[model samples]
Target: MYNSIKEIVTAANETGKTIAELTIEQECQLSGKSRDEIWQRMTVNLQTMQAAVQRGESGRGVFSQTHLTGGEAVKIKNYRASHHPLSGDVMMAAVQGAIATNEVNAAMGVVCATPTAGSSGTLPGILFMLKERLSLTKKQMIDFLFTAGGVGLVIANHAGIAGATGGCQAEVGSASAMGAAAAVEAANGTPEQSAQAMSIAISNLLGLVCDPIAGLVEIPCVKRNAIGAGNALIAADMALAGCTSKIPTDECIMAMDKVGRGLPASLRETGIGGLAGTPTGQAIKARIFGNEV
Candidate 1:
């Protein structure tokens, strides 16, 4: 519904409405759904996210058929439980939570793609981790999803959120930005701060390529969501602390489009460059698909 970050932020400030409210209202107008209907839909999304996270951080964890990604989320949880993590509870919980969602996705389990299935872990991973710490109610968490949706809409309009189109910078990178903006509103930060957070988060992962080993989402894709979650949390805290991005959000979005367009096809989810080109990567692909390599 919003064309640019500038337009969304300025309007939110002037109208004295939260980004969540603005986005929900717009969705109502666009979809002809009542406010309650829209709210209910987002509630279902949040619930689905919760279910995936719960499954991931719990016993054994769901493993992918490829046998590449499984139980890593529980391992992280157990590690945090037994030892004092250098990253602390919030950060490690986010890491575990993010890996859980992607692990489930890789296993062909259900997951609500925040923007894309490959990048589903970032938002819920960060959101649920912060929920208890922030004492956010169910409604507030739902509002956070709406805020994330609003931020994502802006980025999607100006650029792309698909790895095939814009690489991981557009997928995980945009998801990180969306999480940062939504986290800002959840923490009671301003629209300007949300813009700053969004910019900071996206720029952190700028030029990140999609280089899945074995052409599967099991390798770096799952762990990348962990990184995205951390980036979003840091960006949100920085914005709340009055930190600013040297680049504006709208300009950053445009630059992302340009950078993604300039990247070679080998780096754009083709799995023929970066890590995928390594001997080990090739061997794994060969093992999976036969001696095609």
Candidate 2:
């Protein structure tokens, strides 16, 4: 039911329903559960996301033996508290949230796998930031999750949302797209604008590789989530300003699939390529794993 962006938007437009409403209706029909049940389930996910964000913000990111990435989020947080961050409050907040969530994941903390664990940081990062900035209620935040879920459903159905299957373009890219759509909806944008935001997000990060150093979801992964959050915010802003993507959302997803298929095996979640293959990356891996790379 409504696996394509076009279908989702059309249904939303025709029924005078938001994307979240359409998605909730679909979930109820498919699971034979009441709307309340679905809402309760998503609330659990929202709480989990919130907890991870809290842990991350408190600087609990260093979980690996190497201790490479845990303190960056905390550093950013500290810097923001004292200095005027060049990116402003909302962006700084998004960056901290994204880093904190990914830090939690890297440190083996609990996190909601929005589409997947590797890309979990984007949605919550943007949502929590916007929640405070826009004075959004808990119900409005849940609606944001549902709107994001709807975008992710279409992407997963059409292309794929895993790094091994479709590279980081699928992971962070899809998550950014989901975050963008959700941001638009949370700001009272039309479903069509949400679709446009999703497209802009996907297009912005196309062809990104999943080359985590040592095959660990640290290193560039956490920072990439930060960038993904930024992309989502800017894309949402663009959509709200009436900017439209030239390629349609569904077609953009198709292109993502084609690019994913064409990516070299070494680039697709294999630590043997990209950043993981660099001299510094290999040196870090050797240091961490005690292996001669």
Q: Each candidate's TM vs. the true structure? A: 0.98, 0.97
The runs of at least 3 residues in candidate 1 whose Cα sits more than 4 Å from the true structure, single-residue gaps closed, are none
- Residue 73 C-alpha lDDT in model 2: 73
lDDT of 2 by residue, 1-293 (tens): 88799999999999999999989998999999999999999999999999988888773445545577786777888888899888897899998898889988988889999878998898888999999899999999999999999879889988999898899999999999999999999999999999999999999999999898988999788889988899999999999999999999999999999999999988999887899999999998888887964
Give lDDT tens digits, candidate 1, residues 90-202. 89988888999999999999999889999999999999888978989998999999999988998998899999889999999999999999999999999999999999998
Best by TM-score: 1
Predict model 2's lDDT versus the native: 0.90
lDDT of each: 0.92, 0.90
Highest lDDT: give the candidate number.
Answer: 1
**RMSD values, in order shown:** 0.9, 1.3
